[model samples]
Target chain A: MRKLYLAGAGNVSKNLLSLISNLNSDIKIMGIENSRGQLFSEESLSMADINNFMKSPEDYRKSLNISKMDFDIYVDMRTASKNGERERDDYINLMKNGKHIVTANKSGLANFFPEIGKASSEFDKKLYFEATVAGGLPVFSLIRSSFPSFTVDSFTGVVNLTSNFVMKKVNDGMNLEEAKRKAMEEGVAETDMTDDLDGTDSARKAVIIANSLFHKPMRLKDLKYSGIDENNIKKNEMLLAKISMNKEFSVESRVFTLNSEDPFLRLAPMGMACSIGFKERNPVYISEDMDGPLETAGAVLSDILSV
Target chain B: MRKLYLAGAGNVSKNLLSLISNLNSDIKIMGIENSRGQLFSEESLSMADINNFMKSPEDYRKSLNISKMDFDIYVDMRTASKNGERERDDYINLMKNGKHIVTANKSGLANFFPEIGKASSEFDKKLYFEATVAGGLPVFSLIRSSFPSFTVDSFTGVVNLTSNFVMKKVNDGMNLEEAKRKAMEEGVAETDMTDDLDGTDSARKAVIIANSLFHKPMRLKDLKYSGIDENNIKKNEMLLAKISMNKEFSVESRVFTLNSEDPFLRLAPMGMACSIGFKERNPVYISEDMDGPLETAGAVLSDILSV
Candidate 1:
């Protein structure tokens, strides 16, 4: 039986625990850690115990004793860290301890992909982070499994769900501020939508895609991106990440307005869409509906199973 | 190094040979067999050798000496057989000889998936046929890799490229016969477009999907379907495969008209699309452009790499 150590007690982690509990698999959640503390058990934790722990995490206000835990995989679903230093250190340490890693956190991978990737290879452990880019879209997995022998020439995508929602509202004639407010009220945008509107979020995902797909050591600082500002926001415009692999990987996150009849523009407001261009083949288009934490957790579970 | 023995010299096989030649991989084409003859080589066959063999197959018109060949994988890209008896026997024999199988032929798997699957499992060999349905769309691979722990409840797709072409032409104010003729002229429809128009091809693919995805032991005879006739063909209507798994699996192939603004309707005329519904998650939408033999061969190569 494989044991899992969850590194967050947020909604995504809660959804993952619920999914695993209902699934008829041998995977068991051995522990869960949050900002306050952690809860660990040799036996698989039950849903009730997990819920209670989430309700009163202060009751278990103690740091995780990593050396004493017996787990096969470490799942990171924590919120994005500014510098990713803490998450990066945790990932490296976990790999050194002979544990596979699965993550939904983009900051760590975006900031320190090569370092984390090297640590995984050095420890002979696998790293899976399908949820970090487009939630539940299977972008990385499709590229890995379906195009194993093909060369990816370029990629273009609208991966930021929050920005997509805000843009759709703005396209429908609402002002930018009003649209952003509506998105937050509808739970479509995070409370702090600064990174999302400033193009940092999309740029980070682009960097992750380049680092993983093209094997380029790219960081967020290496990219020159422009976000959705009120002055630049147009009626039918949306933020897009355009990545090309020539002599070097060129990633640009900018705003573009697709034709009205374009299929990519027809994607749902809460959907993520990407078109992968190949060397000598027709591009493959993938679109997925990103509802909430459940979908992200589903991607996380998919990565877990892949590992 | 992996050695591949192709079972056809058709367009898809030729495309596969060309692709493998250009690919920088360890896979080598060792032999090719068709109704007219067989060609074998101890060393990897070059593109020139393959083209020459195709140009004058009569020069190499001899039965394949299976026992004398050294190959690891057998790729079947032959045209669909009526009963699939020959292909089934070949797959069984190849598995017995300790070789993995990759196929782009649908009839064989549609008619004898259980038998072929059983042979693969019994001999501890792998069977990959991503090109059999929705060529280059990555349907089976996506489900296998991305939804390992999820239960697929149902699927709806417009997978028949020829029928889609005909329907689009009819929607554009062309008669059925004229549309079919144009498709044939453009090489979008096969010389024998009976199965494609009559829904047999779509039903065969539906059966294959059921047998593979749902693990159902189904046959074509078990399915009840109706072909597209002049009276039945309507404007904006296209062939759809609706498959559901309740207490038992239910598969139906019929004509349906999607909304004008529906994203599925916006798919390219030569594209294949599917929406897979899960038990407790948002459905996944996959669409791919099926330009021709090259795309199908790409899927076949992906399967080969997977094996």
Candidate 2:
């Protein structure tokens, strides 16, 4: 029986749990530290609160009359690292104890990749987190598996869903605040969904691309992220209409913005970023393949699949 | 004979040339506007330039010593509508004559999707651009295929390769100047790659995506684009190593970043955008019956084989 441990049952975490029932029968959950409720229907080896379990696991599990649980992997589904002290240590501890770690918890990895890498190195454990960057997007494996012949100039994309939804609302003519509120109501975004506007999410995703695909674990503080949620674009409907994209086609992608702008003229109104594969004044479409934001993600997805 | 009338001899046009050989042997290139250098093969049809041929079809084809060359599909692969004054009349003219348009050009359809929809209502001319927003990504079909039951929340990715690369170079320690030069020299970039930097590239791709996938053609100007230029990054090799990604991964799907900072305590790093699926985030993978990015592309390749 392949025992697994899961930490922090947040939105994404809950989703992961629901999928576990469809998991290969070879895998089973033995422990989880979610307060909200159980996500995966595994035999609870330790139901004690994370705080108590982190400080002393034996006592916590003992109360439940469980002696020893065999967990092959640990999945951390927490979305952020703001105040997750025990969640962090507990995950680390599990990994140190010959257990692998797979997570959708991008925040945990972003802040502690180097240290985790160091520990995983010493402990000889594996860590996988495909859902960290893009929820369902296959980013990690893209870089991990690719064989180089083709050079990667850079990578960029809408890595943050909250902001993505917010941007979509703004394009739909809603004010920023209203758009944000709507995003949260839909559960696609949070109160702090504005963080995407600040570019922190995109930048964080960028950092991961840099390290995972480029073989560089960058310092988050060093990155300069500018979000699309700035004061400049309040509600430019005409521009939005002309450049706005229809939302009907992108049900999976769920993008809401117009992309029609005069390329010959120097005026640009779409969200974008850069990398090493472009120069001169290429058209946006051409530049996308030659120098667009989604390249790294595309490449990494490809890479991961090959691997 | 199955013939394809290639209109513009730009990237898609040229790329299509390469693709023709891979098609069924019965397919042929009946009327090429210009007898320019072969994109891949030396064999082709009417080699008259578009404008010149349009001016005096008989004279031009006569010059080439042709008896008859009736085209079934007028393949237009010109710069996007975001470009300068395109001859919309020419496209309409082709459609009026019952010629279908297969294009990678966004402007023609994006600029006039509604008009085209209305006109095609009566004319019954089909227009297709499989390589628009994310080249070779099957964006339009994906949306058209997955309708009503599915809802799109946001569409975001490293849409422009030039920008992705530029950011990669900046993270690599090369100043904007150096990265741009290298990109051009590498043939991974376009002549006017700078246009990619202004965010227009992504905007255009986004617009096309919005229109084709979402049925909402967004004006590029309305998009709140945020570009990552080199003035803000370092040219240090060490830093580059810290935040490096490869092109192969990004070119696959979305999610291409060097280091993804996790909101949760940094547990791991993975790039590639993921959408919330019914069960897992990689729903596209599952729904499409593919496991990951490699499978996605591989399946497409297989479809080509089966076809």
DockQ of each: 0.60, 0.02
Docking class of 2: incorrect
lDDT of each: 0.84, 0.44
| DockQ score of the complex predicted as candidate 1 | 0.60
Which sections of candidate 1 miss by over 4 Å? A1-3, A22-28, A40-56, A61-70, A121-124, A173-178, A231-233, A246-249, B1-3, B21-30, B40-56, B61-72, B118-124, B175-178, B230-233, B246-249
What TM-score, to 2 decimals, does candidate 1 have? 0.90
User: What is candidate 2's CA lDDT for residue A97?
Assistant: 69
lDDT of 2 by residue, B123-192 (tens): 7877665444445433444432221123343444444556556556666567778878776876546788
lDDT of 2 by residue, A81-138 (tens): 6533553575567766677766655565556566666777787877665555654443
RMSD vs true structure, all candidates? 3.1, 19.1
Compute each candidate's TM-score over C-alphas: 0.90, 0.40
Candidate 2's C-alpha runs over 4 A off are A35-69, A83-88, A142-152, A234-307, B1-307
